[model samples]
Target chain A: AAGVIQSPRHLIKEKRETATLKCYPIPRHDTVYWYQQGPGQDPQFLISFYEKMQSDKGSIPDRFSAQQFSDYHSELNMSSLELGDSALYFCASSPRGSGRFGYTFGSGTRLTVV
Target chain B: QKEVEQDPGPLSVPEGAIVSLNCTYSNSAFQYFMWYRQYSRKGPELLMYTYSSGNKEDGRFTAQVDKSSKYISLFIRDSQPSDSATYLCAMSVPRNTGNQFYFGTGTSLTVIP
Candidate 1:
């Protein structure tokens, strides 16, 4: 499989500006996930989409939102960014109900909120 | 309390030495346990996964889960310098809502030649 693909491998934004990142899931996979990893920390769950509908959201603030397209592509949007928002963002894909074996991840997008 | 806890160590070991990594969780409902390895400035890669309580081995890596104690471990045999990286432990409970995976702060490992 070609695996998950993410766009804009690196991003820089000024405080209060908006940032958007994109992801394209592997072919035939219906579940997409987003995660954030700060320096020296583990990846934290952000949200997931399955069948073009939001399936779950983690402890992220309201400023963070995501959408899945008809083609199984996904986007993560950050509004009114703050310095603390700087981190690496990852997108992953998996087949529905496949449990642990379904998971496949993308190289992350590093964001620096100045 | 955080659902999962792990010792974030900059652990250094010699090549060919055995390495052990561990994590503890407070959520008794978790039934799926996993270990991931991440290189610096890259995405985390799945290493091993287990359901409930048991041991799973792949190549030189072994994963053990103990549901009764809410503990899990990953052991690396004949460790190589290429094994140097951060190890993260994660678990998930059965659910269709919200992010199911809960992760611990990773433990950093360095295998010295």
Candidate 2:
């Protein structure tokens, strides 16, 4: 079974720089969700898309933007990064028929801003 | 109060001991309950899931849901060192246009051999 895939397992950036993260959800999955987890904290929902359309939003910062492409893959673009933006970014996918248990997460991308 | 509450315990126990983790939520609208295990530097993986209420068991893991109390529990019997990880509780309403998940702070557990 293919799982969600996130690019740049580890990322290092300087404050005020920009970065972009990519996510490839499981094949056949329609919904993709993005989450950010800080040090020793629970994962916070950032945003979500269904069928390549923006479906929901969460605590995502104004400097960050995301979009799901026609291929069902998604990208998160962050600009003017800050130290606080350093965290683990995770992507999860689930098909429409699959319930909440269907959420399959990828090996997250660890972002470190200095 | 937060939507979900869980004790952030660095619980240490010897191997073969039973491990119990718990969480409480404030939303009655939630119908699906899930438990996820996260290893260091890895994303969370689903461990158990329950709908509505009652008890569900799978091998060494058992999950109990008390809808009336808005409480859920995960019990690992005969725990092993390999079972050591962070446990997170998540709850959500039925799947709809915009399904959102509420999570607890996660409890860290360590089982020593």
Candidate 3:
């Protein structure tokens, strides 16, 4: 079975810099999701993409944006990063829009904003 | 109030002990409950998922949901050292567009050998 994959497993950026993280969903999956996990905390929903369109934006600020190129790929962008932006960003995929089977998550990209 | 609440504990237990993890939610609209296990430096892996009320068992893991109390739980029997990880409780409400999930802060477990 194909698993979700993320690029740039570790990243370091200065404050106010722009950072982009990429993810490839499992083959045959339709919906993709992005989440942020702060140190010692659970993952927080960032955004979800379906049908090549942005579906939902969570409590994240506008400085964070995401895009889905196709059914199998998505990207998360953080512009003008702050020290608070430093966290582990995860990508996940689901076969359908409903909550039938839970999401399969990627290993995540560890972002450090200095 | 936050939709979901969980205790973030570095709960330590001996091997072969049973472990109980739990979460509570304030959102009555939440219809799906899930438990995920995340190892250090790794993404979360789905362990159990339940809809609404009742209990579901798979091997050594059992998941229970009580809609009346707005509580959900994951019970692990015969816990092993390999089972040491963070357990996250998540739930979602049905929406016209898509389901959005709310996650708890997660509880870390350390199973001593």
Candidate 4:
């Protein structure tokens, strides 16, 4: 079975720089969710999309934006990055846009802002 | 108050011992409960999930949910060193909302040989 795929397994950026993180959810999965995990902290919900439409929002920063395309892949765009942005970014997917069941998560992207 | 609460335990137990993990939530609307095991630097892998209040057993793992108490638990039988990892409990509501998942802080367990 195909699992959620995240690109740029590791990233390093200077403060004020910009970056983009990509996610390819499992095939046929229509819902995508983004989460940020600080060291020793639980994953925090950022944003989510269903069927290419923004469905929910959480603690995502104003400097960050995300969207899902028709192919079911999603991108997280961050600008004017700060040191606090350094964390692990995870993407999860569920079938038929229903998290009522559960989600399948990606390996995650480790972003380090200096 | 936070939506979910769990003890972050660096628990150590001997091999072959039974391990128990637990979490509590404040939301009464949460109808689905799940437990995930995450290895260092890896994604969280789903271990078990239960709807409403009941006990579901799979292999050596058992998951229990009590809606009335807003609590959930996962029990591991005959633990092994490989089972040493962080266990996170998660829950979600029905389809009316975004149905996003809320997670616990996680408990780290180490099985000694």
Candidate 5:
């Protein structure tokens, strides 16, 4: 089965720079969720989308924005990045109405801000 | 208090031993419970999932839910070194709009050979 796919397995950036991460959810999955996990910490919910529409927001920073395209893929754009933004970013997808157990996560992108 | 609580244990045990991991939640509305195993620097991989209450077993893994106590557990029998990883417990409430997952602080386990 096809799993969620995340781009740029590893990313390096300097403070104040901008970066964009993309995600390709599993085929037919209509919900996409983004999470950020710092070292030794649990994954923190960033934001989520359902069917190309904004559905929920969590602890995402003002400098970051995301959107789900018509293709069901999503992108997370971060501007004026800070050192604290360095962490593992994960994208998960689930088929609508399949319940919570349907969530399938990607390999994740490791962001390193210096 | 946090929505979910789990002991962040760097627990070590010999292979073939039974390993138990647990989590407690304050929300009574959470209906779906899940267990994920995350290797270092990797995304979480679902290990077990259960709805409502009772027990569900698969291979060497078992998941138990106690709705009345607001607690959940995952037991790995005959553990192996390959089972060493961080275990995260998550729960969610079904919603028409979207569902948000609450995760507990992961427990790091190491099974020695």
Candidate 6:
């Protein structure tokens, strides 16, 4: 089975720099979710999309924005980065768009802001 | 208060020991409960999931939900070192406003031989 795919397994950026992270959910899966996990903390929900439409939002910062394309893939764009933004970014997908069926996660992108 | 609470433990246990991990929640709308095991630097992997209340077992893992108490638990039997990982309890509502998943801080377990 194909799993969620996250690009740039590791990213490094300087404060005030900009970056873009990508996620390719499992084929045929229409829902995608983004989460940020800081060291020693649980994964925090950032935002989510269903069928190319933003369906929900979480603790995502104002400097960050995301959107799902018609292809069902999504991207997280961050600007004016800060050191606190350093963490592992995860993307999850569910076929039904509800996590009740269990969501599949990607390996994650480790972003380090210096 | 937080919607869900769990002990953030690097709870260590000897090999083959039975282990219990738990979480409590404040939301009554949460009907779908799930447990995920995450290895260091890896994505969380679903261990077991249960709906409403009662118990569900798969192999050496069992998931239990007490809807009346708003609490849930995961028990691992005859554990192995391979079982060492962070266990996170998560829940969601399947009806109104069901797109979000609430998670626990996770309890880290290390099974030693």
User: For each candidate, what is the lDDT?
Assistant: 0.89, 0.92, 0.90, 0.93, 0.93, 0.91
Per-candidate DockQ values are: 0.55, 0.69, 0.75, 0.72, 0.71, 0.64
lDDT for each residue of candidate 1 in A15-70, tens digit (9 for 90 to 100)? 99999999998899889999998888778889899989999888678999899999
- Output the lDDT of residue B32, model 4: 86
Model 4 chain A poorest 10 in a row by lDDT: A94-103
* Runs with alpha carbons beyond 4 Å of true place in candidate 2: none
Interface RMSD of 5: 1.3
Binned by DockQ into CAPRI classes (incorrect, acceptable, medium, high), candidate 2 is medium
User: Is model 6 an incorrect, acceptable, medium or high docking prediction?
Assistant: medium
Looking at model 3, residue B24 earns an lDDT score of 96
> Residue B63 in model 3: shift from native, Å?
0.5
Docking class of 1: medium
- What are the iRMS values of all candidates? 2.3, 1.5, 1.4, 1.3, 1.3, 1.7
Regions of candidate 1 where Cα sits further than 4 Å from its true position: A100-102
* Ten-residue stretch with the least lDDT total in model 1 chain B: B91-100
Mind giving the per-residue lDDT tens digits that candidate 4 earns over B1-113? 88999999989999999999999999998888999999999989988888969899999999999889988999999999999999999998765446868999999999999
Task: For candidate 2, list the clashing residue pairs, or say none.
Answer: none
lDDT of 2 at A26: 91
Can you write out model 1's per-residue Cα lDDT over B1-113, one digit (the tens) per residue? 78999999989999999999999999888878889898888778888888857889999999999888889999999999999999989887878553388888999999999
Q: Give lDDT tens digits, candidate 6, residues A1-114.
A: 899999999999999999999999999999899999999788899998888988888999999999999999999999999999999999999886456757999999999999
> lDDT by residue for model 2 over B1-113, one digit each (tens)?
98999999999999999999999999999878999999999999999898968899999999999999999999999999999999999988764566788889999999999
Q: True contacts preserved, each candidate?
A: 0.49, 0.59, 0.75, 0.63, 0.57, 0.53
Ordered by DockQ, highest first, the candidates read: 3, 4, 5, 2, 6, 1
Please report the TM-score between candidate 5 and the true structure: 0.97
Candidate 6 per-residue lDDT over residues B1-112, each given as its tens digit = 8888999998999999999999999999887899999999998998888886888999999999999999999999999999999999988765443457888999999999
| TM-score to native of every candidate shown | 0.96, 0.97, 0.96, 0.97, 0.97, 0.97
Worst 10 residues of 6 chain B by lDDT: B91-100
